[model samples]
Target: MRLLAFGDSFVLGQGDPDRLGWIGRALAGRPEVTLYNLGVRAETSADIAARWRAEAKPRLVSHEPVRLVFSFGANDCSSDGGAPRLAAAQSLLHARAILSEAARTAPVLMVGPPPMPEPGAAARLEALNEHLKALCGRLQAPFIDVFRPLAADGLWARDAEAGDGGHPGAAGYQRMADLVAAHPAWRSFTGAPET
Candidate 1:
């Protein structure tokens, strides 16, 4: 399987102690899957939407199943003094366009934005997660809610706070990897259980 992980700094595993980030940790031992991490720091969904096809196209190969996993919106939810960096409506519109184009060729799984250590960010992230869920429903894509569960967890919260006020440490990234591992979408994508 060929997997493409695209998004922002969190997806890149910015503060992880192991330096592997969540994506690398999640797919570490799986030799059958080839993962391309295209996570950029400080990028909004608009940026990802703009570059997804061009970035993802050449990497795709024939005779192999391709899967795309996106984790974004943290930057979008960030406030510039008072206003969000990317408006909620624009975020969804970009998502609609990106997912519409990607799903036509490969299966897509969306991992909603993780919680940041900033004040009032959790609620905003939750709202964005809900919006993503609805969008995923309409698009027939699988959505993973990483925020809801991690919002209340001590490990993720503490690690995120202790790190850089944004990215989490090794323990938190491991937890994220665990969540993705347990998800049915992971199972469906890998097909290891069936084999």
Candidate 2:
């Protein structure tokens, strides 16, 4: 099976102690699976949408049982002096377009943005997640809310507070991996029997 993981630094496993971000960690020990980490640092939904097709098409061609995972919106919620880097509406539009197109080609899963230590960033991320969840519903795509649960998670919150205020450490990513592991959508997409 082939997996395409795309998004920002979080998807890249920024601050991960093992350097295998959550994606790598989750797929570890499964040598039969091939994973491409196309995550870029400081990328937003717009950046991902802009580059997704060109980057994913070649890899997906003739690749049987291909699946895609997108983790983004943190950077979109980021602010440059009181102004969001990307407006919520624009982010939603980008996500809708991206998810709709990707789902047509392959199984798609979306990991919503995580919480940031910046003041009020959590609320913004939550709002973004809600919108994304609704959009995914309409598009018949799977959505994972990494924001809400992580915001309430002490380990995740502490790790984020300690490191860069955005990306978390190994524990945080593991928590994320754990969440994905338990998700029915992930199981169904991978054809892995429920745990």
Candidate 3:
């Protein structure tokens, strides 16, 4: 199986070492699957919408029956300056459009952004996460809610973030990978035994 992970810094594994991004860590030892990281730092859903066909599609379409792991929303929330509700909705629509396009050639698994440590960002992220979950439901795609699990329990927030104060540290990325790898959709996709 071929997995294409596309999104922002989280997908790029920003806080980890060169080879230990969450995508790499998550797929480690899964010899049956090959995973590719197509993440860009500081990218928003709008950016993905604009460049996906030209940039992401080539790599994605090359992999037959591709499995897409889309991790976005954090940058969208960070950059949003308009009304929170409106901005989140707009971002969600953009994400939906990209997923719709990818679904024509691949199976999609939308990974919601990990929770923000900032005091005020959580509410906006909550809205974005809700919209993403709803979109996934409508599209019949798999959804992973990384926010809720990590937000309250201090998993990703347990350690100091990278220079940006947004991206998590190595431990945080590992937590993310573990959380994603344990998701039912991931297990089903890889046919791995449940945790």
Candidate 4:
């Protein structure tokens, strides 16, 4: 199986001391699957929507099954100065277009962006998360919501607080990967038989 994980720096596993990030940790010891990490630093939803298809096309030429996992929005919600780089509405529009187009080529999974420990960050991200979840539901896509649970997690908070307030350290990334691994849809997508 070929799994392509797309997103911003979070998906790239920035700030992780061991550098596995969540994707690596989630797929740990799974030699059956091939992973392509297309995570870019400081990219917004618009940026990813603009380039993912072109980048993924060449890598999917083989006979192997292909799957796509998108986990962005942190850069979109980021404040460069006074306001966010991309408003919530704009982010949703980009995501809708991206997922709709991606689903036709391969099975797609949507992983919600994790929370940042910055002021007013929760409100902005929560709204985006809710809408993204709803969008996934309408599209019948598998969605892994890492926002709310991580927001309340002590380990997550500790790392975010100590680090850049968005990307966490090894422990926090492990926690997030655990959540993704435990999701029923993730298990199904990864071809792990149900427990």
Candidate 5:
């Protein structure tokens, strides 16, 4: 499988010591994958939508199956002083465009944004997640909700309490990997079990 993962710093495995991030941990035992982690720090859905196609087209192999995984919205939910970086409706608009284009090119899967360890951020992100879930449903693409569960468990909160509030350590990344690896959609798409 040729996988191109696009999103924010979490997808980049920002705070992880090993630097493989969740994508690596999820595909840890699989040697057959050709992965291109195109996760950029502090990028919103708009940023990803703008750059993904240009970045992905050159790397796609004509003969092999390709997959695209998108995890964004965290930065979009962020408010510098007044409003969010990207409005919820605009975020959905970008997603619709990205997923529609991506599906025509390859299989598409979306991992909803994870919770921020800061106050009031979970609710904001949760709302974005719900909107994204509905959008993905209409597109018939698989969506994974990492925010609610991870937020409830406080794994990211704990990590933030220590340091690096935005990105979690190796364990948090592992938890994300486990979630994606165990998802039926992922298994069906990749034809591989959790590693």
Candidate 6:
């Protein structure tokens, strides 16, 4: 099996050890699977959508029975500034459309953006994640909520997050990987026998 991960620095495991990122750590010891990171720093949902066909599709081609993991939204909030909610919604809808198209060729997993540092931004992040979750449900794709688990008590802001308060360090990435691996979707993806 092969996993194609696309997103921003988070997927790249930015501040984490060896830059292994969460994807690298998550698939570790799973020799049966080959994982590829197509992450670009500071990429937004819209940006990912724009480049999906050109950048990500080629990787997906060789990885038959592809599992596309999408980690986005953080950059969108950072870039949107004070944009109106309706505008953001429209942009998200467009991004989802692109993802829908991609899903036709492979299974898709939508990972909600990780938590941010700014206190005021939580609401926006929540809104965006909610939209993403709904879109994933509509597409019959799996959705992973990374925000809530890392939001409270400076979970993503801890030292384990590498002092950036944004990207996660090794421990933080491990936390993320653990949560993701335990998620129902993950079991489905791996086709592991029920526990």
In TM-score terms, which candidate is top? 4
Better of 2 and 5 by lDDT: 5
Looking at model 2, residue 72 earns an lDDT score of 93
What digit string (tens of lDDT, one per residue) describes model 4 on residues 1-195? Answer: 999999999899999999889999999978998999999999999999999999999988657899999999888887855698899999999999999999998999999999876656567888899999999999999899998888886788898678887678999999999999899889999896555
lDDT of 2 by residue, 1-195 (tens): 899999999889999988888788777666777899999999999999999999998898673779999989888988876978888999999998899899888889997887787766667878888999999988888887767777776778788778877678898988887777677877677666545
Residue pairs with backbone overlap in model 5: none
Give the whole-model CA lDDT for all candidates, comma-separated.
Answer: 0.85, 0.85, 0.78, 0.90, 0.87, 0.75
TM-scores, in order shown?
A: 0.95, 0.94, 0.88, 0.96, 0.95, 0.87
Instruction: Give the range where candidate 3 is weakest over 10 consecutive residues by summed lDDT.
Output: 77-86
Q: Which has the better lDDT: candidate 1, or candidate 6?
A: 1
Which one is best on lDDT?
4
Candidate 2 residue-wise lDDT at 70:
91
Superposed on all Cα atoms, model 4 deviates from the true structure by an RMSD in Å of 1.2
Summarize candidate 6's per-residue lDDT along 1-195 as a digit string, tens digits: 778888888888888867787778767777777788889998777777877777665666653567778888877766345653344576577657867887886787877788776655666777888888888888788888888887764556684445576777887887788778778897687553465
Worst 10 residues of 1 by lDDT: 186-195
What lDDT is reached at residue 194 by model 2? 45
Clashing residue pairs in candidate 3, if any?
Answer: none
Model 5: residues >4 Å from true position, as ranges? Answer: 193-195
Candidate 4: residue pairs that collide: none
Q: Per-residue error at 176 for model 4, in Å?
A: 0.1
Evaluated against the true structure, the overall lDDT of model 6 is 0.75
Write candidate 3's Cα lDDT for 1-195 as tens digits: 777788988889887755567778788788777777889988888887887667655665553556877888887777345443237768878987999988886777888888876655767888889889988999999998888888877857765354457777778888888988888887876666655
Angstrom error at residue 115, model 2: 1.1
